[model samples]
Every structure is written in C-alpha cells, then in structure tokens.
Target: MAGERVSLDDALSNVDVLDDLPLSDQQPMVEAQSCSVVYTANFDTNFEDRNAYVTGIAKYMEEAATHAELNKLLEEGEQHAVMLYTWRCCSRAIPQPKSNEQPNRVEIYEKTVKVLSEEVKKLTKFMKFQHKAIEVFCNQVKRLCHQEKRKDFVSEAYLLTLGKFINMFAVLDELKNMKSSVKNDYSTYRRAAQFLKVLSDTQSLQESQNLSMFLATQNKVRDSLKEKLQTIGAHEELLCEVVNISVHMFENKMYLTPKEKQMLVKVMGFGLFLIDSDGCNINKLDQKKKIRIDKIDKIFKNLEVVPLFGDMQIAPFNYIKRSKNFDAKLWPLCSASTISPQASLMCHLPRIREEHIKYISDLARYSNEVITTYKETARTDAENRDISDLAQRGLMLLSDWTSVVTEVYSWKLLHPTDHHANKTCPIDAEEYERATRYNYSPDEKFGLIEVIAMIKGLQVLMARMEIVFLDSIRKNIYQELQDFVQLTLRDPLRKAVKNKKELLRSILVSVRETSADWIKGYEPSEDPALKGKKDPDQGGFEIKVRRRNVGSEELELSLYVPPGPSSTQLYMVRTMLESLISDKSGGKKTLRKEMDGQHLVLIDEFHKTSFIWSYLLNFSGRHAPCPCNFPNWHGHVRRTTCLYPNRHGHVRRTTCDVPRACTLTGTGMCDVPRTCTLTGTGMCDVPRTCTLTGMGTCDVPRTCTLTGTGMCDVPVPVP
Candidate 1:
C-alpha cells in the first residue's frame, strides 16, 4: 500500500504507532538506499564509489544473489550503518541509551532514516554559501584565466569546480522518493522525525550525523576556492573576509572576460528594452518603486573598474578617417589581442561610448597632473641650476608613459567621434596655422587627443633632457676635476724645481762655457775681414780700422785699435746675472755684492752700448787724437773720454766713441804723404831734381858732386 500524507502534529501524537504502517509503504528505492549507505559508510560521493554502491544494490534486487545472500547483505548493511552513525553521534558528545543485545532491524533502519533526514535538511544551510563559492570561482576564471602566469592553474581549478557542480546536480536528479520508490520530491525530514520519537536523544543523533555530512562537502568546496585564489597569486586576505576582498566582491564580481562581459551587458540592456517595450506609461506596480538615477549611476560607475577590450596598439581613426586623413601605426607590446569582437559590438552602444568617454576624461585628468608636475619640477630644477634631479624625474615620467598609453588606447578606441583628428572649430586659417605649431589644435590641448600627444612628447622631451642636461653636468664635473688636479700639482712642481736649484745653476754654467767655446774662433758673416771692398767702383778702398792708414792714391791706410774685455768673460758674467735676477728670493742683491772688477767692466760695457750710434758719434768727433806721423802708421787707439748730451740736457761723461775710431784730425795736416822719413812730417833734404823731393839725402849718392842744381854729373860735363 502507498503511504498517505499525515500532518506532523498527528504523527507526533501517535509517535508509538508511526512504524505500524506497512513496511512496503515507506521503503526507498535501490539508488536512494545505496546513496544513504555510501554516505554513512565513507561520506564519499566520488563517482566510482557511488556507482559501486548502486550497482551492488541493483544486483541484489535483481536476484543475482540468493534469498539468503540478499538477507545477509541487508543485515550487514544495516549493522554497518548503525555502527557508523552511533560512533559519529558519540564523537559529537551526543548521549545514547545503553543497549544490551543487538537493536532490532526496524530500530536501526529508523535511526539511519533519521540521520539521512537531518543530512538532507542541513544541506539547505550550504545553499547560499555554495552559491557564493560558485560566483567567486567564476570570477577568478574570467579575470585571471587569460593572464599568462595564471592561465594554467586557474583553468584547472575552474574546470574542477565546474565538474563538481555538474556531479552534484546529477546526484540531486537521481534521488528517489522514500514512499513512492519512483523518483519524486520527498520529505525525508517528517518520516525520520516521526519514526525516531521513541528514542530520548534522537535529535542529538540527527544534529551530529546530518550536519557532519553536510559540512564535509562544503569544506571541500572552500578548499577548492582557496586553491583557485592561491593559483592567481591573490593575497591570503582575499581568500577570507578582508576589507579588500569584501569591497572587491561587491564591485568586481561581474568582471568576466571582455567578450562575456560585453555580451552580458548587452543582454541586460535588451532585457530592459523588453520590460519597457510597450512604451506605455504604466501605473506604478508598487508605490515605493521610484527610478533612482543615482543608484543606477553608481552601479554603472563601478563598471569603470572593469578592464576594457582596448588592447589596440593605436587608437581607431574611423571617425576622422571619413572626414579627414588619419592613420594608426603603433603596435601593441602586450600579448592581448588587438581586436575583440565583443568590444567592437560594445563600441556601438551609446552607454558604452559614454562610459568610455568618462574613462577618457579620467585618463586626461591624470595625465595632466603628471605633465603639470613634471613641468613644475623641470622649471624649479632649471632655476636652481641643477639638472641631476631633473633627469631622474624625467626618466620616471618616461617610464610611466607605457601604462598611460595602454589606458589611452583603450578609451580612444571606444570614443565615437574622433574629434581630435577631424576638428574644424576654428575656421580661421591663421588660427589653424598657430595651433599646428604645438602639433595639435587649440581645442585639443586639454582632452584625450592632446593627452595622447602629450605622453609621446613627454617621452621625447624627457629623453632629450637626460641626454643634454646629464651630459653637460658630466662634462662640467670632468672639467672641474681636471682643473683641481692641475692646481694640486703646482706646489709639488715648484718644490721639485727649488730642490734642484744647484744642479740647474751648474747646467747653466756648462751651457755658457760650451757657447763660448763655439763662439771663440767662429767667423761671423758681417766681420770686417769678410767685407772685401767697401767701394765697388774704386781700385782702392777706405779701411777705417781704429786710427790706421796706408799708402795714399795707391791704398790710403790709417789704423788704430783698442783691446777691451774678452767676450767669453762677458758671456759668463751675463749668464750669472740672469740666473740671479730670475731667482725670486733676495739672490739678486747678494749676487751684486759678490761682483768683482771684471763683472763691473762687463756691466759697464753693456750699459754704455745701450745708447745708439748717433748719440755717440759726436764722442768720436770731439775726443779723437791727431794722426800719428807717417812711417809710424801702426794702429793705435786712445781711450777717448767723450762729452755727450744726456737725456737730461747736461753734459755727461762717456768712455765710448765710434765702434772703430780714426786718429786723423779734422784739419788737412795728415792728408799729405811723408816725404823721406818713415815717421810723421819728415821731409826730403834735397832740393828739386831729386826723386825724393824733400829728403835731406840725395837718392843718387854724391851724383850731384856739390853742384847744387840737383842734376846728374854727366849732364854738367856735357854742358
């Protein structure tokens, strides 16, 4: 007979007779009974174990075993179930009544049924928690599944959780109703509760055994969730109820892959379209339901956290392409696909476009902050005449551009109007020309387009700053180091020179001696001996040696010379004087005190020669001695003390004359030749008709024979 439904109150009132109904009326089918058996035996719902349990029960029911064998299987299975349940209840600290003999089979079955009933009821507790677990798993797969580092682990965990869910649904589908034995929804709770009312601690057994089985499954699921989180490098707090995870759960749970998220958002929009399909001003379904734009905006604003499908290397130029020329040339560095189909679909949505614009606005604001900060820092650095900090900050900005461009590419793709590329606001040609100077239109200076250009410009500008400013600083430091080294070496060099002063003076003396040796017998090109003839046209030449002269009309000659200080002695003295003067200390005065007479003579000669020849020429004229008599024309020189006008216009004493002076007087007294004597002014003694016109003796001895006519004796006899 089929069991009839009875109220829980009536069953409680008649608890003693609850098992009096026909046994066949409440027997669960083979699968349900086997599920309870396996659950009680091992608490394992793995496929192989569940299958073996069901298959064995089916074989027994199909009579594959004898009647005795079937009876033995049932007895053994009931005893095992009772033992396990009793142990579980004891472990939980639940009290149990003492039993002397083995409990009746009916009593065991009733207790087992109560345990399964509690297990089923407690499973309800995990419904909300299981749903959250599934949601969390889905988000991890969607968000982290595509990451290069996370793909393998996250995918494995995702499929694992998905398989668990599928198996759970399959088990729920195969469960049989307790009374019908044909699968139908059944209340294992009421049947177990009425049958177990006879026992004092049945509620305790129910709580311990039922809740344990339920918690076992959920704990496994939580472990799987923990594994998945770990695989994605999530923090430990993210696996728990930390603030970041809580906020993340609320805000980011809907972050699917770009394609799935795009489809989901579109489906939601379509659903709204259907709800408002009639375009009717329908009466309020509930008076409290007012459309809250703020709430809607808040929900939509949270969507900004979602990663967009803007993985393009360069922004789309579609809008500007039709109105003007545009091109995109940048290549993506990241491995994400350049084009996503769902992203293309989302690009057409008005709401998506608006969201993207808002995102672009955010990017623009952030980039402006970066630009303004960099400009200020650079300006301050320039003012302080320090570029070390400037170069560092510029490099930081350059490195930051990679992420900035990534964000800009995403937003610029979703933007509907390429206003930056095709702007025509200022119609004036001059304005357009001016705007192009900065490589952008004036209107584009603060928005997305300018922001994009600004990032690129900043990269270039920062690189140049690093090169120019840093290099200049390096050069300046190098130059300063060189100068410091030179200055540091100066004192040592001066000390070394001072230490070698004696050796240097010896070298100077040696050099002077060698120079004198070379000059001793050396003939100069301007020596008077090399001057062949002073007058080229005449057969005779005038030689003005001191005061010497020779034969008149043949070769007039007069000579005079004076011997002065030797040149070698003069050179050595001059060299010593130079060394003394060059010595910076008080060596000059000491050297002057040590001078002897020869040093004084050389110094005096040098001072006398310092005047020009014209100034001393009058000395030769005024102080020259008269000519020596002929036949005594040997060279003689007089030490002429000449009076010459000094620079002060007073007569000053001078010992110098012409470099080679003559002894002839200014009168013609020395012009005539000497007649007979070799000495000066000696005249011939004979009258006319003698070869020696004025000699005292005749050239022909006694030829005149006392004839005073000064003719030969033969000419006198002939007359």
Candidate 2:
C-alpha cells in the first residue's frame, strides 16, 4: 500500500498543471474534446453478456494506453488518473445496457475534465497578463513624473504619458471585475468535481484525491493574483500626487508661460475625455475616485466635454478643430504629421485660446471693480482713484468692451458729471485723469478709457447747453445734438486727440459749433408745407431744388414751398436786402420773366418810386395726389423758394424784424387776401397767379386748391 501511495504521488507529481494559452486555441480544444467523446461512445463491442462487455472495454483500454498514437496521454500522468476516476464514476452512474446499446457516460465525464482544464488555463493567462500590465503602467507613470521638467510641461512625451496613466485607471478597474468573475466560475467547477470524486470507487477515489489538491493549487494562484491587483490599486496615491503636481504647475501663473498653460488645458481636456469614456462623472465621483484637485474640479464643472462619437477611444489633441471649453491656441506643439491615429480623430469641437480665457477673466474683474468704484463715488461724493489696474493686463473681445462703454455712457447720462457736486456720476475728473495716465493698447485704452472720457466731456458740454438754452429749444434739438456730437465731433476727435490739451482743444471746437445760433434757435416747423424736409436749416439758409427730365404724357409740375416764414428764409432775405442797400447808386427797376419749363422769373431791381413784377409758371395737370401728401393743399413742399403776390400785383418781401434773433417774427409787406380761387374758401391759401403757356391758367389765390402736381392751380377767370 505504501508503494502504491508513493506511485500515486509520482503520478500526481508528473501531471502538468493548467497554464495560460492564447484565446484562439480554446474553441479548438473544446471541439476536439467533443469529437473524442463521440468516438469513445461509438466504439464497437461484439460481446453477448455484461462480463464479456466489461472484459472487452478493459482490453480496449489496455491496448489504447500502450498505442504509439496515445503516447501523449500516457505522458499526461495525473490526466490519466483523472480519466480513470471519471470512467469509474460513469460506470456506476449508467444502468445495464442491451447488446445494441452504446454507453456514453465515460466519454462525457472525460470531456468534462478537458473543458474544465481549458477554463483554468484561460483564467490563469488572464490574471497573469493583468498583473504584469498593471506593474508596467505604475512604473511608467513614476518614470514619466520624474522625467517631466517645467520647460517640457507641454511636450508630447509628457502629455502622452499622462494619457497612458488615465488609461491605466480603466484597465485596473476591468481587471478587478474580471477577477471576481473568475473566482465565481472556479468555485462552481470545484464543487461539481468534488461531488464526482465522492461517488467514485476505492481506486478511482484515490486517483481523484489529487484533483482536489490541484484545484487548491489553482486557488492559491488566484489568491496571489488578487493580492497583486490590490497592490497595484494601492498606487492610486502616486497617481494623485502626479495629478496634484500637474495642477500646481498649471496654477503657477507667475512662473509658467501662456503656451504652457494652454497645453495644460489640453491635457486636462484629454483626461476628462478618458474619464467620460469609462462612464464616470468627475464632479460627482466618490471621494476615493475623485481626482482631488480643486481648480481642476472647478474647471471640469465649468467646461463641458462633448465627444464627437460616443464610443470613441482616442484623445482630442489633433482630432478636435474647435472647442469652446478647451484652449487650443497653442495646440499641435508638436508637428501634426507626428500625431498618431490612436491619439486623434477627425472631428470638430468649440475651443478658445488660453490668452482669450485670461482676457475674459480680467475683463470680468475690471468691469466689476469699475462698477463698484462708480457706486462708491456716487455715494461718497468724492473723487476716487482709477479702477483700471486690470485693464492693461490683457485684451478683451470688442463686443464685451462695447458693453463696458455702453454701461459707462448710461451712468454718465443718469448722474451729474460735476466732480464737486453732491450727487456725482461714476467716473469723475480725477478718475478720468488717473485712468488715462496708464498706457494701454488700442483695444482697452481707446475702447474703454478714452470712450468714457469722451462721454464725460460731452456730458459736461450738454449740461452747459441745458443751462444756457430754453427748455423748448433744447427739447427740439437735444437728441439730434447728442447724436451729431457723438458721430461727427466726439468720435473723430477721439481718434485724433492724443493729449489732454488736444482733447480739451477738440472739446472747445465742438462747443463752438454746437452752440451756434442755428443750433440754439432750432425749432420744428409747425407749417404743413415743410414736414418732410429733414433738418432744412442744419448747414445753411439755402434752398436746393433738383430738376429731372420727364416724359410729356407723365408730366407734372414739382413745386416746393415752406408752410410759413422761417428764420432761414428771413436770413436769406436779409442778406439779399443788405446787398441791395449797400449799393448807393440808383438802379433801374427792370422786370424780366423767363417762360421755360424749369427757370424761375427774376425781377432785377425794385425801387419805391415804381414797382415792377415778373412771374413765371409751369404746370402739368395730370395724375392724382402723390402718396407722400405732396399734392395735398396742406402738405409740405420740399426744397422750394416762396414768393408772395399782393392784390395790387406787387411781390411781397419779408424783413427780419428781430435783427440777429432770426426768429420767424418777420411780417410780409402786403396784406394779401386769404381766399382760394378753386374752392373760394380758406382751404389752400396763397396769393399768386401763374399761366402754363399751352395748357391753361393756374391761379394761386390766398387759399388755393391742390393739383396733381404740388403746385397751387385754378382755372383762369373768363373776362
């Protein structure tokens, strides 16, 4: 028995332990096992009784064991023992069969052992590969962390190393879950094998005992793999340290350059993509899983990470073309040709530059500070220092800068501009002076500081105008004056004026032009005849009439007339009278009338002794009133000179009664009858008579009827 026990030990010792094999080999091994079972079950047995059948099986087994083709099975020592034990169990499990029956229990049991061995081999291979891969990843992370220099922070090697580390986290997680599944499957296989061993006969039981010991060895190997995975997982602290160091380098604004910051942002974006690929939320992760960098965490929360394809495995270094959340201004630090396919994709995302991020941040800070300073200045009624310290640090978007200008303009409009006043505006003279003292680029300095200065200076001028002019006069021209000052004067001067002296000189020039008599005495015409003319007295007191050639069939007279006498007209008449009176020599009173379709009649000279009048009239009586109300009796006429005729056939002229006031207080020389020739009432009133050479006579009575053309026309009275 002791010799038999020793022989059994030797057999168990020679049994090859299940080892790792490639996954491709597993299916073929399973198929081979199935074929072996089928061939063994179908083996011919020409015996009449159970003993003969048993004897026949023994002879077949003995011959099969010694066969040269089965030499490999003999070399598989413990495998033979397992096969023998399985055959014994199969013999007891199966009932006695008829002569024609084919027994398959032994074949099935032998196939079971082969399948179990294959599973063990696969599980072992998986565990070993995972363990080695994890160790390599951890060591590589350490090497990369050590090799990284401040200058090489944005280098491709460093960034790719970081990406590998991120990938390691996912691999480690998969390893743990795989380990659990292997353990469960092994437990089930071991339970079934133990049950079969218990039911075996004495010699078969002895042979099957080693199977339990082999399974124990497999359990020990699995346990060791588990311990190793745990050891690798414990290195999370090392990963945390690397991440923290990187974040610290990024946050070190005083030392790192803009290029480095931009690269760091890209690296963080890549890490975020890896995390998202694993179905984990950075912000909402558990404490153990969190990256633990406050700034990085904040950035992750603030910026969105949208993947082009949901299952994409690559990073976005060269793949992404645009991304608002990630800074890519200094991206492709390495050559684009050097980028590997595994690291990039052909996709687009919104992006911004690191410089732009800083600019926006600084702009937001400056805007808040300026607004606060404005509130303080308003509350304290004291001059405050300039709040433009952050303005020189970076450049901002033009749209954002325009908003600041608009805010400052609004504040100036609401509050008083005077620094000495009890209720003052946000920006005062002292603040403006200090703000302007600093040298700034065109974007910030001109866009914000100088723009605010122009607004403040213009506000002061407007306040002075408010004090000097009447409320009614200001009401008519205040809005137009503001727009004119901004567009024509303030904007041009802002570009040209450099120094305070220049600015003040420009402001003085603006004051002179804005405070002229024409601007200050401006009023909206109440006369219906001057409604459509846009600022007729804006530049000078001159009437402009444009003539266009028209077809005879569509011919119509175009007449422009003022509703009532205006200061502009009075000014023109005054200049004419002055020119006439300035000549001391007596002149002849000549009457000359031009009868062309376009030219106006001219009376060369008029003396008090004798009056001579020349009149020319052109008319076309066709078409209805124009949509612009031009043909209505009470409608306004644009760009036309007015001449009034009295009952005695003498032209009436107006004189400026108020001298330089130039108000519409002048009176006409004649007391013309206010009666319309067409309606014989006061519907359209004017005093003139015109004759169209070929068509008919058009009479302009005190109140005349409207014609197809805007001119006053009436049928000639039969004499």
Give each model a TM-score.
Answer: 0.15, 0.19
RMSD of 1: 65.8
lDDT by residue for model 1 (173-222), tens: 11211112111111333333445653348665665454444333433443
lDDT of 2: 0.30
The models' CA-based lDDT, in order, is: 0.30, 0.30
The residue-level lDDT of candidate 2 at 355 comes to: 37
lDDT of 1: 0.30
Each prediction's Cα RMSD? 65.8, 51.2
